[model samples]
Target: MSDPFDLLVIGGGINGAGIARDAAGRGLRVLLCERGDLAEHTSSASTKLIHGGLRYLEQYEFRLVREALAERERLMRLAPHIVWPLRFVLPYDAGLRPAWMLRLGLFLYDHLTRLKTLPGSTSLRLDRDAAGAPLQKRLTRGFAYSDCWVEDSRLVVLNALDAAERGAQIRTRTTVESARRDEGAWTVTLYDSDKRRRESVRARVVVNAAGPWVGETLLRTLSVEARPKVRLVKGSHIVVRRLYEGDQAYILQQPDRRIVFAIPYERDFTLIGTTDVAHEGGPGPVVISAQETRYLCACINRSFERQIGPDDVVWSFSGLRPLYDDDAAANASAVTRDYVLELDTDGPPVLSVFGGKITTYRRLAEHALDRLGPHLPGLKPAWTGTAPLPGGDMDGADFERFLARLVAERPFLPAATARRLARAYGTRLEHLLGDARALSDLGETFGGDLSAREVDYLVRHEWARTPDDILWRRSKLGLRSGRADVARLGRALANPSADPGAQRP
Candidate 1:
């Protein structure tokens, strides 16, 4: 309700939500505004890993890798529900890099940081190991390593939720139209895209965590003098029918020395991605091009015997990586995923972030807050490293045991629904599925495993204002639901007040 906040973060992506949560926890009065849903632009489109980029060893980015590796464990401990450890099966190919080099990389990735909850990397013979069963029999050897799989969009929402819990205001569908220094504070005009309403906010500092839209948010929206140059790299993904038998994810090494992942997703499908190409246009409207579709399908077809064609592709999406324009002259994959903070301090400070991975958002937030230290007189020390994210209070963040106990407690919920709720809500699964005796009590099924009750919770609690926000971002139902289900959800969310819990102030 205040015109001026102590801090105003521009984007609602992972970086923005992280900064907002950090700053708010440090006792800064904060306000976060997103033009669309949280992670609508880029954050959710990530490969959804929270591991040290083993490939970055070639770039000699030891610092970034170590920090990312450490953060991966920390985040898994913080949000055990949305973030969990996953084993990546790096299938070996004779055409790709040698086994010794891959081993060296895995060795470094394992020893880069102090060990914690996750296990170390190991070698596997494809002929004997279960992880290799689905792969083309030509693959004889592989390396199994640990990484984290996160509900990328939920990471943003949980951070935003934690920020709000720490007394920050999160405004979705709100865009920062203009920001100007007035006296010693920032006068920011935020426009609501849905209501066509305008409001003003003031902040001693502002953060432009606008991901792919970072440059545009500074130049077009805020009219700031300082602009951090960012290179937009387009990456795309395709969802296909489950190709493998187990929950293990595949990391395919391509001839171009690039890596692609085939991760088990949404129970019945596998998620394969992504091709890196330079993109110089709008980020919001980015889509999977025909070439990208072919590229992904070809990569899978080459690796698997089943031959996943375009017809088997059920869903596809694209995102632009707003990389900090480092001096690398090659393609998007070579561009550093490391983030850079550009502070525009002509009057009221503006900290703009560029090019960060979902793996390192927490540390990125601490670093961003550190940059704002001179502006905020009495800011507290960083505390996110130890604090558990909202529902991640499980014993030592071991989600498997927690899920087992949850299912034991409520045998009524189907195994699939229980696992989904437990994964989505952690210890708070009790709250979401409270007193529901049967599937009917979970409310109307919206196709897939999505239910009306979960939709209501997201709308009332997580600020999901649109159907796609619920279907795609908040939940992965988009991969499972049909077009008719989406259309129905659209009509329902368009007038969400009709839902039992959709009313929000």
Candidate 2:
């Protein structure tokens, strides 16, 4: 029987985290509950781009593209550590999209947003350029455009961290068992998995940003029945050993009219992906199928000089997108990438978020608040666009300069480790490193430069409870960690009291 909250956000994915952060900053008493770890689902499984969705233009989704493009610049400023500019090369083919069509699309992508900061698109002579080294010899002409890369899971956690700092309660591994409107408010029953206990609380408004589970949450959790407005589309990705020798990514157009991306990944690997297949099952555990693996390999083999097969895939993941059912396009790839917010006023106000991508999450939050403003009084104006996310307060949003400064300050750190820490924690590295002058001061290492000091920091501040939380989401060092490393880390987390000398900052 805690004090009633002003807002209860049920989901820890990007949208829910963003809404919680925005609402809390606006002075609302907010509570965010997630059934699993934050971003354990769709948010972390994204293609990890903060782009305008260049393909969405073909579907006539101009507003979505424009808003996303604008948000790209804002995110780069707000989280320069995790979001940065990336160049993508789209190679030309004799039979696929005409060169004129490619140029037109690039032109529109370049001009859609007035706040463009990245370099504009340009036609490339792939045969003579370094970008052409790995591509097929026939792919001579192409176009290069600008987008941005994001540490998707970290982005979600940072939003939740900001929300907590602003006085919002973020409860991970907590599930909303049921919610019912009672006397102009919502009585929510939450089940904390770790504690195996249930508690009841009240909320003035409920925001269902449950991502793929929006429909399930409505029917099973909230006892609301209505025609489903969400279309479940599953997208998957694969990671492999390094494929090329450049920082730029490639956008290969398939004969089926869909495009796939091959981007430089973790220093030693390449990331490829994203197949859109209509998901018929419930939103549960999903993995890349054999068909999908082959399809992706075939797509890559069609354009690249370095051919690969399913055997080359080192890792793969899949996630479901609960798209707003426009009910016009039957094909999953043709479905709109836009979002829809449905507000139900029959009882106490409840807002259900239908479809949204990682790029436009901030705007979605702003719009969610705007939609709820009439019911909730004394809310502050939108301010997230100008605010820096946690650890994103570097001067001028210049990550390189910040990295150089960090290296100069801590010359003891290895160059690679310094860059990784700089990119992951930004200005917060000062706090993490705290009074320490050497690597030994950071405590025991668990491979991949992961230290006990950093582990304690995550446990104390980031709501990290397990090895997977530290390995996969908070950082992607899991790719470099081995079984022994994971086991060691798990033991350390289970018995934190054993590390008597572990630094706590």
Candidate 3:
């Protein structure tokens, strides 16, 4: 083996990617391995909100809420292109949570964090307000609160990109098959699926941030005999043709005492989610069940003036949340979302992470590094909070001003295409455009405004090897792309030399 790395992170989800970025920025040699494309699982399948869990107040998870609320502000500053403020309307129901209770919860949510970039909560006159136009006539009063929306998967890929730029080796489509401790270090065996080959490397410390597979990675891959503390809770979501005309989202309370969100998505769809059902089966590929589809549809149908059934669901997805099992929750929905980090120092130190949400990922990385500080001496202090991600170096985090400038300079780009590029790449749009003065200069249109130049940029800088990597995660152009577009993209990827913009060393 070559020189041992200071840290080896197993998993490419948000937590893992964040850790790798943090460790690499601290001048430690780091390696991050993922079994599939980055954020292919839970990280990408989030409700995509960067809010303090307003409901967690009922469970008394104050610290988690406070940290998440603060991080929400920091992330907006750090990645202005992909993270922005969102308003949520919570319609009142006399049969459900009392009005005073909702007010109290929103009050705590607004004050929990010191940073206040977004507006505070206020009572809404649903009958008079435009936000109330879509709600059922029976719902006369509601509340409006502030949260932030994120391009979830893109966040993961950007973290990995930043980590790689900071000298961390990010190996996607590579699995850590096994790891063994030898002489105060870990001998890790990785299987690269694309190459169909196995390789071994050494690392002083290993971090297990494998979302749903954390338990299996420890028991099977690492051969650790500790009892797994993770409880698998499956959350599912559905997408349909736009349910409303506004950018605002709705948070609906169900009779079961659980809450669901219906948010405007992708410009043409309304995203409704998230049923928390216990996942009895072991972690693998998960799909939204018929029951879940009905549950979500019913959730929207109950509150919206326009009703929808399962047939209206254009797309659906499910992901398993590996929550830290507190063992006292009455049901899956009640389980604590707080994370627990366990350090096993039997030989080489291995830290296993359990149950963290996307909002608190940065803090989780900081805490993980703090836990490993003793074993790995001379570590730098936390700095991710202040630093910007790869393309988020815009002044004052002013995304709109940056976008206006991009459009002004590249008037050749269609307004929609320019906006999409600015959102996806921020200041990096110049790298992709590269002196192009016309639409044809982008090369090879593949529907959904996706072009050959963009694809090449993704492949070269973002580690995009497949079309799905571009369509779904890198950008949600998949919603607009068809089979023909996918086939064309696949063909383009198959022949790298065909791309005129391919960098020649």
Candidate 4:
């Protein structure tokens, strides 16, 4: 523990985790610390689409859209199990934007990149198309285009897993109490919340990837003076019962000009959301406000034949976006989703990451390392783009084929359980489901298809310390698991030492 780390990344969100993975793979000793579970905030509370931001095109963010579009395909390849193709229907309204303008934007989106696996945008007649059945009769014409859906929280966890695999230290429930530059290196003091102990680590450099708390991390955690450099925008979403029967989703443009997405969720629910409201306070557990809920319901009701009210909302979550304050845009929705990386070379370098979206995290990490390259003499070249994440190196990145093989090997699991495991773990499932011939080997059912075996795997390897981690983050089984089931799982995690094989360290 006395040895100095080459890099210490101070955040467990997508950007921080992605940088740690990239840095570790580049032959640098890395450490990543999070005060809570990974993706427990902005990274998890997303619209859950790996999109090119079709709306941004209106603001002339062509470069951002282009890069995001390219990475959308790369993510599909790099994490096929969690990210997949989704078609979106944008119903035309004469009152909103003219159809000709919509057609032009769609054309630009299609031609933005040279490489794409999805089909081009095409016109749809609501009366003739299955995607149109849920919409009102008045919305007869629309355009359908391509995007990808992601298991947002799992993506963050996978990045940390890959970083850990590449010899980086990932400490969850650890906070950076203070960091100060001394002589030519950074002395970072971390507080282990689990052990209630403090430990100091030496690192050649520090990365402040603390998303919403970027400013606070600088002034309070690192003891540095900085201005109001970031804009805290709050985005919220609502989950309700399944709104439609089809695989397709809808992107409805409201009278306010803000677009809302109503996509299929976790089998039995419809995921509708995302209102961009300005956040004026500190970061914590964000919830959808009454106004946001009403706004979202109104947005959906504009097109869907089935009307909904606030009471229909089964669940809702909110997160704050740490957008770099460019001061050019006034509205939260109009603010750029692009990121800004600041490297302070005043002493031993400390890199600060600000204003980034999930779509471009990989590229951001590469750029981060490139900025710090001068300080670290022997850092290796960029390698994450061509590399596959943990369990992502399947044949042609074909999740369905890999899933079929997994189920074929373990016929004990029900089809639903096997598919869920495959989607969550991919190739990692083989090692997780080790040496069990039937259902009995899985041990202790905790409701749904959640078994003792999966819990052990999550604890031993993936850092599941609570029932909520397993039920909500790693797998969205919380949406289905009953109260009794959750309580039992909670007790199991509370005493990890009870199981002989469960990890203690």
TM-scores vs. true structure, each candidate: 0.95, 0.98, 0.98, 0.98
Supply the TM-score for candidate 3. Answer: 0.98
Model 1 lDDT per residue over 277-332, tens place = 89977766688888889888888877777787888888888888999997765777
lDDT of 2 at 314: 88
TM-score, structure 4 vs. true: 0.98
lDDT of 2 by residue, 1-505 (tens): 7778999999999999999999999999999999998999899889999999999989889999999999999999999999999999999998999999889999999998899889999999999999999999999999899999999999998999899989999998899999999999999999999789999999999999999999999888888877769899989999999999989999999999999999999999999989999999998879999999999999999999999999999889899999999789979999888999999898988899999999999999999999999988999999999999999999999999999998998998999999999999999888789988999999999998999889888887888889999999999899999999999999998894743222123
- The digit string of per-residue lDDT tens for model 3 on 1-505 reads 7999999999999999999999999989999999998999999889999989999999999999999999999999999999989999999988999999999999999998889889999999999999999999999999999999999998998899888888899888899999999998999999999778999999999999999999999999998889999999999999999999988999999999999999999889999989999999999879999999999999988999999999998888889999999889989988999999999999999999999999999999999999999999889989999998877999899999998898888899989898889889887778889989999999889997998899889887777878888898899888899999999899988894743222111
The lDDT values for all models are 0.85, 0.92, 0.92, 0.89
Q: Write the per-residue lDDT of candidate 4 for residues 1-505, one digit (tens) a residue.
A: 5989999999999999999999999999999999998888899988988989999999999999999999999999999989989999999976999999999999999999998889999999988988889999999899999999988889898999888888899999999989898868989899998789999999999999999999889878877666748899999999999999989999999999999999999989999989999999887778888999999999999999999999999888899999999888889998889989988777878788989889889999999999999999999999998887777888999999998888787888889888888889888887778898988898998889899989888887777788888888898888889999999998887885744233222
Report residue 176 deviation for candidate 2 (angstroms). 0.3
TM-score between model 1 and native: 0.95
Which one wins on lDDT?
A: 2
Judge candidate 3 at residue 475 and give its lDDT: 90
Q: Sorted on lDDT, highest at the top, how do the candidates line up?
A: 2, 3, 4, 1
- The worst-scoring run of ten residues by lDDT in candidate 2 lies at 496-505
Residue 325 in model 1: lDDT: 94
